[model samples]
Target chain A: DVKVTQSSRYLVKRTGEKVFLECVQDMDHENMFWYRQDPGLGLRLIYFSYDVKMKEKGDIPEGYSVSREKKERFSLILESASTNQTSMYLCASSSGPIYEQYFGPGTRLTVT
Target chain B: DQQVKQNSPSLSVQEGRISILNCDYTNSMFDYFLWYKKYPAEGPTFLISISSIKDKNEDGRFTVFLNKSAKHLSLHIVPSQPGDSAVYFCAASRGARAGNMLTFGGGTRLMVKP
Candidate 1:
């Protein structure tokens, strides 16, 4: 079975602080993605990496950055956490382009 | 401008009834469509998907219908169960290697009653 795991289920950070959200997948998928879920907004893509050392910005990439230094791990970084950035962060992995994506449970971050 | 749209914000249905969720997209280049279900505190999971060439696709109790000309798609859940209560998101993909990203709708919350 495919499994995606996040570093934390919940996280609290102060405003202006740098926060890192980590994700690891066991499936060794070639494509990994980061997304944020907000009320009524659904899942908005933040970033995605098609291969190691490669990254692409998604629709809402202004406040976020991603790193895929390794094949099994992808990390999302918040340079400066803001109140508006407090939301559910999700990580997903897919075996190929435009395929089914397996997701982690998600990390709910709160910026105070 | 939002390319994909889920007009309905929420829907309530009883068990054993059919629940229909609708979605529309403005981009005609979208050749593949998908539906995802998300529960509280969890990431959205892939539910079903359909290609532009096909009008409909079914998986167990879930069915997805696509209308290429109308730029619309809908998800139908037969005999809606309480566990089926969750938020449904509609997504579209353009099918290009460099631009193969899924554009998602806002989402529609569904509540299934026993």
Candidate 2:
């Protein structure tokens, strides 16, 4: 079984604070993704990394950036946390060609 | 504009009955379709999937049917149990993309009542 682990299950931060959400996968997948889920909005991609040091902006990447220094770890960074950024964040990983992504338990972020 | 759409926001079905959740997509380029089930406080789990070449795919109690002509797909859960209750999301992807980035629909909440 593939395991994807997130650094934090829940987090609360003050406005304008810097926040980091980490994700690690044991399956050695090549693709890692960060997504924010909201009611009525579904899961919107924030950023994704295809390889180490390579990143691409997804549909809603504003105010959010990602890092993939290693194959097993991916981190999402919020430059300046705002109340609008408060939501459930999810991390997922998938191997080549399969397209079936395994997801970690999400982190519910609260920016006050 | 929502490329993927789930018209029904919620559905309630009796246990031991059949539950049908429908999804539609506007992009004809989408060749791969998937269904994911998500519980509160948990990330979405991959349930089942179907390719454009095949019309139907079945896994245990879950079955996905795709209509290429209409650019639509549906998930059918047979003998629905309480455990099957969750928010179901439909996603589509164009296979040409290297990462298979998905466009998801607004999920439909399914409630299985005993």
Candidate 3:
């Protein structure tokens, strides 16, 4: 079974503060993704990494960035935390395009 | 504009009954469709999937039916149990061109009453 683990389950940060959400997968999947879930908007992609040091912007990449320095780890950075950025952040990994992605438990971020 | 949409935001059904969740997509380029179930405080889990070439796929108590002409898909759960209650999301992908990227629907919350 693929296991994806996040650094935090819940986080609260003040406005303008820098925040980092980490995700690690044991399966060594080639693709990692970051998404934010909001009520009535479903899950919107923030950023995704296909390989180490390679990243692409998703539909909602504004105010968010990602890092994939290591094969098992992917980190999402919030440049300047804002109230609107507060949402349930999820990380997922998949071996390929057609394969099913495994997701972490998710981090509930609250920017005050 | 949202490419994928779940018209119904919520549905309630009695246990042991059938639950049908619907999803629609505007893009015809999508080659694969997926269903995910999410619980409170947890990430969504992959439930079932169907290829564009196929019309139906079944797994255990869950079945997915796709209508290519209408660009619509539906998930049917037989003998719906309370454990089946969750937020169900429908997603579509354009195969290799998208590189695992998927467009997801708003999701419908299903409540199975005991």
Candidate 4:
């Protein structure tokens, strides 16, 4: 079975603080994605990596950055956490360039 | 402009009835469409998907219908259970070369009541 794990289920950070959200997938999928879910907005993609050391900005890449140094791990970074950045963060992985993604239990981050 | 849109913000349905959630997309290049179910504080899960070549795809209680010409899709849940009460999001992808990047619609919240 495919398993995507995030470092924390909940996180709290102060404004302007640097925050890191980690995700690791055991499926060895070639594609990894980071998304933020908000009340009115659905899951908005922040960043995605198709392969190691490669990344692409998604629809809402404004307050986020991502890194994929190894095949199984992808990390999302918040350079300066803001109140608007507080939302449910999700990590997903897919074997190929398809939308059939296996998702991890999301991390709910609260930026104060 | 929003590429994909779920017009309905919420829907209330009675148990054992059919619940239909609608989504529309403006991108003609979208060849694959999918539906996902999400509960509060949990990640969305892949529900069902349909290819542009086909009009409909069914997976037990869930059926996804795609109208390529209309650039629309809908997900139908039969015998809607209380557990089905959650937010549903519809997504679209252009092709494989797009690196599986999915453009999601604003979710529709479904409330299934007994």
TM-scores for all predictions: 0.96, 0.98, 0.98, 0.96
Candidate 3 residue pairs that clash? none
Between candidates 1 and 4, the lDDT winner:
4
The stretch of ten residues in a row with the least summed lDDT in candidate 1 chain B is B94-103
For candidate 2, what is the interface RMSD? Answer: 0.9
Compose the digit string of candidate 3's lDDT tens values, residues B1-114. 999999999999999999999999999999899999999988899999999999999999999999999999999999899999999999998777534798899999999999
Candidate achieving higher lDDT, 3 or 4:
3
Each predicted complex: what DockQ? Answer: 0.63, 0.75, 0.75, 0.73
TM-scores for chain A over all candidates: 0.97, 0.99, 0.97, 0.97
Q: Could you tell me how far off, in angstroms, the CA of residue B60 lies in candidate 4 after the best superposition?
A: 0.9
Whole-model Cα lDDT of every candidate shown, in order: 0.91, 0.93, 0.94, 0.92
How big is the positional error of residue A105 in model 3, measured in Å on the Cα after superposition? 0.5
**Model 4 spans with C-alpha error above 4 angstroms:** none
Pairs in steric clash, model 4: none
**Tens digits of per-residue lDDT for model 2, A1-112:** 9999999999999999999999999998999999998888888889988888989998899999899999999999999999999999999999878877889999999999
In terms of docking quality, model 3 is: medium
lDDT tens string, model 1, B39-69? 8877788999999999999999999999888
Q: How many residue pairs of model 2 clash at the backbone? A: 0
In candidate 2, the residue pairs with backbone N, CA or C atoms under 3 Å apart (3 or more residues apart, or in different chains) clash, namely: none
Off by over 4 Å in 3: none
Ranking by lDDT: 3, 2, 4, 1
Candidate of highest lDDT: 3
